[model samples]
Target: MTPKLKEDAQRLVIYIGESDRWRGKPLYAAILETLKAEGLAGATVIRGVAGFGAHSHIHTAAILRLSEDLPLIIHVIDTPEKIEHALELVRPMVREGLITLEDVRVVRYTHRYLNPLPADRLVEEVMTREVETLSPEMTVAAAWQKMLETLIKAMPVVDNSGQVLGMVTDEDLLERAGLQQRLSVAERLDKPLLDEEIARLRQSPLRVADVMSKPPITAQAREPLGLAAMRMAKHGIKRLPVLNDQGQLMGVLSRVDILRLLSEKPAMKMTAPLGATQTVRDVMTPVIPAVQQDDELPEIVEKLLESGTHRVIVLDGFGKAIGLISDSDVVARIQPSQRRGVIAALFGDALAPSSSVTAAELMSPGVLTARPETSLVQAARMMMNPKRKWLVVVDEQDKPLGLVDRHILLRALTAG
Candidate 1:
């Protein structure tokens, strides 16, 4: 139970019958609608996978099962005062099932706002603008180097005009390399024309465009985080690029940035709703860590984690964000042999692996970037749509700046 649960407020669990003949749809809808009308904070409905109660019968193996046989669970969290008021109407009508009450603690809560004002807020006040980027012409070697130098898992690929072309990820690079390695030995030993095949493999040209994912998704600097999260969930992406009104790249956003903003202690209390008076700049992490576009993966990882942070920004020689690297990127680059060796060391073997892997072996060359003044809400939306956890802050020159996490935004909201 959450310690914050108002003594007068209680968490309620209401179970209803699952008979197909009964008004199941109406009942479920009524329960939810009533809860909302009564102004309860929130309610959840769970459909049972398989279970039976009071009837004492096994209920599986049915093709066209009706509503009566199905099970429904309803849970509502709110102040005891609200619960009791709503229960007054619920208790009389619900006669057959179970109605229980419990005390619990809510780690965080937010006051719902109906009509929020926007004048006091601007996108820049909350958007994270620092970012990293990558180019399409870089090789696997150069991409890997950038990852090591920046410590980001994925990078946005963009063109000279500052428009995003696509996105490249560490996973994509490693998967390609691993597949090539698997084919190498087989072709070398099993084929009668091994020499010819080897020559072809060596001569093969690898370009960023060959491996990059195109048609990148983007967000405006004024969009809200809630909408951003919905887009991310629907599209199954990890990050979104932030763009200005002119469609110029401004920054990148990831899930971690949103989480950083939401998880902060100050935002936990129900007060003004998020985005009421906030802007992207107000919540963005300003001091971005970055690496050159030509750097390698090993170096990117080293520098990204040097400050004990999990991510870093990538930039070109001129200082624009080219991409980002994260702990997950590093993990993706590890080979089975390396994993075994690292595990062996955990069991007391003191010797380190002999190979000297460089960042150029692990990073993606192309990167996506954003402007420093982009809105935090828009950034969060982009991160959620793409399912990414980090974003790079950058300048107009496309130079890498800082990194932002979702949690930071949530914190700012709570504090404000």
Candidate 2:
């Protein structure tokens, strides 16, 4: 029998505007603070690479043509009562913009931080150390074995200099294999193919360098959870490589980490509770999957698939996450149409040509982001108010950090 999905009347709304006149950072900070003050779960901001408004003016980040016409999207997610409370707060700021609300189902809900004792508190207290790593020169076989031994989906790739170059994960490895299979089929076909095409497939090797994602995304250990969530959503990734002050790989964070944190917390009941004082860092997953940028994509994809994770963190020469590669990202690089169709359905958009594109081609860069110190309340407000399900978390340097999903917050509330 299909179990009935425990339904909650939690509603969220997102806000967008076309002017850069406002202080984006401060606005985000304020939103987070406001949500926390009101006892909401979280909020988030999503930056757009390009956008159009009622005026039909194209907005972008080109310096010479610096289009102030760009739009900003703000998301907030919370209980029905909290949603109303948050809307009242942002009403004054709703000038020359768009605000839309959508209904969302809460799969889980809880308070991420229950105990305040020093011994039982802080992310540093619960985060895992002694993380696994990978090297560019490592063979696909060796990397695959490591993933099996460690029971992890991704690994950080480092060099002799202790610098992170990229990341490799099971997803990346799988994508490479799929690519190889496609190449092999094409080669076997009797149809006359270009010499370049034949040579590319013939020479393709399942090496770490061939599969690893370059310019990996990373985060500092001390960063907050709010920022990390935002980064994950912005990049459409599920993991963030953690680094130390020396730029050495410290560990990795994953969506599962966030979910686990939510699982450990108390579930929220129907009665409205008092405001929460916790931050994202208080609940972020300290252990993560990392890999070198130069690792073979096929090997990484294999590990990721085996580990049952959707994303991997890529590190640079300094052992810092510089880029991220998710199953969605890798799939987009290979199969654009399927990815596009899925994304379009998720966003409630028509299955048009624009919707049928890959994450690499469709994803917006220079994301609207938040820092670790940001409040969960504000994060929730951003996510709920804008009705956005995902938020990217970043450090003060605006590097990719982690992600916060509406479902994650809701789970915490339910668990509370």
Candidate 3:
């Protein structure tokens, strides 16, 4: 049995004439550039032998001299959101042309793997160009709004000479917005009350300079990517502003870039060895906090802040773990794939024009669980999954007992 097409995809078709120009440049070239700039995997352009549309003019390549305005089709395939982005980018450039979108299933696809750049690659070599920067003078409210729209977690703040001044992250913005006081997602709230709170937070009269981390941690363009990673991990920073010898911002690099680098390096997946382990009960955190499904959102946030833990488990009447929620689940504007769909529902009350909601609506549904009697190695193995972040430790009767965090797996790997 071999692998076949088993994934959903989308294809965008753009119908344009060969002579079409955007900003005085060839339309086809402009479209290709846009797709590449947006980080799409790939695209193809097909030239038609003969075609006529809209104006009903006969434009054919039958004769080389009369090949003017020959029909061309640009095909791009990618995720739905990315496809939408491509369309938005091309819409203004394409003044006269037909653009259509359709669903497609990816079948057999093949490509030669490109070798990953050496680990010692310079910071500038891996940093993304066209980085966005925040002005220290920008309002905290405006900054959060911008970050929300762009799906960026952090941004570098710069001075007038393009000098890196500081860095601001979502966490910084949220704390300044006074969200910590209302972090509990399991609180009862009237629609208007939630709206007022959200609105107030957004309208805070604070500037980026007031909350951003001053004298930002940065990477020199000449430094190795590994050094940047070490600095990032040591400081717990998500991204670093790349600066040139002139002390001006060059670009930006982050953990995501490192992940991409590892993905390209096939030889990098080294195994982590470990010693024998006994039972899940021996390693599990026996004392775990529990929240009910129907609890209010505010109460949930309060519990999370007070506990200082990454996440809290949700339990049903019988004390069995039903679901779970974390701080990211409540704060992230866009829910990550790793989180349950209910994460978005967490904001349902906040976004709804008029409504009230509970913790059940905001939790990651159907929690991952492990039995206390299960082998510690097996539990650690389960936690090794990159996407499975947290799990509930349960008793013999499926009652809530403890939690198995990602940290537990790291500890297990070193137990040998």
Candidate 4:
């Protein structure tokens, strides 16, 4: 049963014809859904027995034939701000109806148990207090140095007053730091783009102001950590710049920060609610050692056992992945012996795959993969079905870029 609102709380009463609909959904249902989705405290939908509108057309639910135009009232009792926001959203939905607001003190508002701790834990609790901020005038080369030294994926581009103006990431630096500018001095490296040449190119004069992703979407430190996690995932960011009410940078919240916290929480569960808007890249293990398709079974098995990967990518001569061999395939193939099942435990499903019978003989015909940008939620769903233990993170050409497993989903859930 739905909980009752306390006596004397602000209530938004929306009256619309039962037949009214916005975007094909019944107006009452649409509004109620919106209110609930928006996390409003409580809402109720009432149907009138008899009523007449501005058109003077009488409507009644007393009989089935005339029920079409019955008066439908949606009662939403919450904070004033929520009611006002919901009112604006309902305005365009009810093309022709009456809406009213009243001050009713809610003495019995309920459903408290549903939320573990709404707005109880602020972002400041889990945010990294020490932030490595970037200045608009800081050279891309300088920023790259910091990124590599700290191994932090992103940093906020802030003004002298500490107000965030933009955000810069390693990818932003890699692309704009002149690394792709053909060795800067050597039009095209007659040799290869070596570490030295790349370093020289990175020393170019491009500034953070020129390369950062500007007009960054930010979050307030006082808000719930879940809100910050949602913003990060929704925007496909690994971390968010924590800001004060004055819009000044305060700290940074990262997937790792949240993950470490969540992983330590004894109450944390894989099903814990969280925003999975963060991409696979946030948690993916970027480097998974690979083996050729023809690599022998014993050698591959040994590698899978030691590498701690359930499946390994089988690459062709050109380094293009052709297939995958998993520990499951090995378990299914090997003539069972009395020896303990150590390999099975090591792989947990190998965690990254083949042996003769050869990698070609044991591999799953087509390797399942996910892109770096795939949302964690979507990736979780993809990884969950078909009993897949893990997914190979791939690039545009289906080149193996990394690997993501069930742990990724767990981290995403807890980060919220």
- Specify the highest-TM-score model's number: 3
lDDT of 1 by residue, 115-135 (tens): 121223333334567777788
Tens digit of per-residue lDDT, candidate 3, span 1-416: 11112267788999999999888899999899888877775789999888888999878887665648989999988778788888899888878889999999876343321112344788888888788779999987677657655667678999899999999887676566554222233132334544555577666788889999878999999998767766766666658899999989999986556545543444435432121124556566777876787776556755665577757888777777877777555544223331223333343323212223455776778877887766544554455444565667777788877776645533432221
Of the two candidates 2 and 4, the one with more favorable lDDT, higher being better, is 4
User: Using alpha carbons, what is the TM-score of model 1?
Assistant: 0.37
lDDT of 4 by residue, 24-57 (tens): 8887888888877776766788888888989998
How many residue pairs collide in each prediction?
127, 122, 13, 30
TM-score per candidate = 0.37, 0.35, 0.46, 0.42
Per-residue lDDT, model 3, residue 178, is 50
Off by over 4 Å in 2: 1-126, 177-206, 267-270, 273-416
lDDT, candidate 1, equals 0.57
Provide C-alpha RMSD values for all models, in order.
Answer: 18.3, 22.5, 23.5, 16.3
Report, for every candidate in turn, its global Cα lDDT versus the true structure: 0.57, 0.55, 0.67, 0.67
After TM-score superposition, what is the CA distance of residue 205 in candidate 3 from its true location, in Å?
5.0
